[model samples]
Target: MGDNIHLDYKYLSSLFSSVESITFEQYIINQKIEHAKELMVYDEFSLSEIAFKMNYRSVA
Candidate 1:
């Protein structure tokens, strides 16, 4: 079951790599920030916990 839901990292890598004119790193950062904002609205977890879950070193 878990195996059926997995990230196609290779495909994503190829797609991101082909975007020659895009700021791909910034795109990823923006997406993460948006997700954090959404989670903050829910108020389920503390900011520090959310930042840790998102792999941040600290809740800046």
Candidate 2:
């Protein structure tokens, strides 16, 4: 898993280097949505837990 993370980091760094510019808000939103999906599908954490982890004020 650590090796995978290293590879993923390299890939992301390459992507960022290639892109002329990036929006932090869009990136954060996309990551949060992906994480929310994972939390829902995996059922490893409750909605509130996921929301809190994502820095959301509420599940609503």
Candidate 3:
């Protein structure tokens, strides 16, 4: 994400945390979980498939 915006990663993370009050990694996980919930509503993929698509280490 920083590369796309042409900022150093450390700087970007600092800025993000300052503005959002959450670390960038945690923000990403929240987004992925929200997207997974949306996908579940659509019912197009199984739980394991959603976990895999979200890069989770396990379905649990």
The lDDT per prediction is 0.79, 0.77, 0.93
Across 1-60, the per-residue lDDT of candidate 1 in tens digits comes to 124557576665566768854456767888889999988999998999899888889999
The true-versus-predicted C-alpha distance at residue 49 of model 3, in Å, is: 1.3
Q: Tens-digit lDDT track for model 2 on 1-60?
A: 237556675567557656836554466678889989988999999999999998999999
- For model 3, the superposed segments whose C-alpha errors exceed 4 Å read 1-6
Error of 2 at 44 (Å): 1.4
lDDT of model 2, residue 52: 95
When sorted by lDDT, best at the front, the candidate numbers are 3, 1, 2
Clashes of 1: 0
Instruction: List model 3 lDDT by residue over 1-60, tens digit each.
Output: 778779999999999999999999999889998999998999999999999999998989
Kindly indicate the candidate among 2 and 3 with the higher TM-score: 3
**TM-score leader:** 3
List of clashing residue pairs for candidate 1: none
Provide the global lDDT of candidate 2 against the true structure.
0.77
